[model samples]
Target: MGHPLLRRRLLLSLPLAAATAGGLGFYILLERARQGTYNPQTFSNPLVGHRVPDFRLVGIDGKHGFGSSQLIASKKPILLNFFASWCVPCAGEAPYLDVISKSGVDIWGIAYQDKAKALAFYLAKYGDPYTRLATDPTGRTAINFGVYGVPESFLIAPGGIVRWHIAGPLVPPIINEQLRPELQKIA
Candidate 1:
């Protein structure tokens, strides 16, 4: 019923439309992949060269309270770790942190979004590496630190300046390679 030239043009246009649809779908998939890689779970703050936030919190020891001021008063560099018992990455870093603590780096830990009982159990199981353990019952302390999740560590100098911030898990190589050198400089 249609002219031969018109029929040929229609067939050509159909292939073009299909190619455009396929291209669009591929582009969307690529964009999704990029977004997935930028997930918050993989993100860490750039706290280096910034002053550490100071705040008072109830210590896990239940006998004494603690704040950033106490760490600054020590006149020695400090490592402040934010963790939670429920966080798998936090658990993974605990043993390595215990090793680091023995080096006299003045490590302090803040329990974020955790129950007191769970915190006690975690410390008991993993061995408390922190010289002072603070509990953030309502997660307010973590919010102040600009924390979106657990297993973050901040390196603070004697003057209370945050020298480094590591988000997510702290692997042994990271401690040995990245953290150790920075600590040596501060020490």
Candidate 2:
């Protein structure tokens, strides 16, 4: 209903306005990232601060396995780790896990979608730090644990409540800065 030239200008301006808004949104996200307040890797799991879900996972050999009862019956805190032989980060964290285990912490490993043979070789090469190992070949146990991917870890308290979780490899910085502090709190 307006003049043709005015109508054309308005239509052209809409795209520019939309693009400007998009740019502004991107800038805000970038600023947040720069400020260290927005980590893209950070995700909230509903399982934190709650009891670990019920699961029965067979070990790599299918004969030796672990269940929810085993975890709940533990007298001390445990680190539940989900890893796969094929994950590079899992390999990277292997040594640190060994160190942590040496410090008297129990680490329970769940091999996610990995073959027994491959896991055996991986442990032989990387050094097995798990006090107990189980296999989650179908990843069902991981789903119950709310694991997003391999190399995720949950700190379970004496009674099997998941007090903390980290969705990455347990590198030195994480060991010293985050995991150690959490361990002290429970101790």
Q: lDDT for every model?
A: 0.80, 0.89
lDDT digits (tens) for residues 111-169 of candidate 2: 99999899999999999999999999889889888887889999998888888888878
Collision pairs in model 2: none
Candidate 2 off by > 4 Å: 1-39
Q: Candidate 1 has what TM-score?
A: 0.74
What is the alpha-carbon lDDT of model 2 when measured against the actual structure? Answer: 0.89
Of candidate 1, the 10-residue stretch with the lowest lDDT total is 32-41
Clashing pairs in 1: none
**All candidates: CA RMSD in angstroms?**
7.8, 6.8
lDDT of 1 by residue, 1-187 (tens): 7999999999999989999999998888777446432233455565568776778888765756578688667688888999999999898888889889887777888888788888889889988998888888898778878888888888888878888877766677678767889998887
Against the true structure, what is each candidate's TM-score?
Answer: 0.74, 0.79
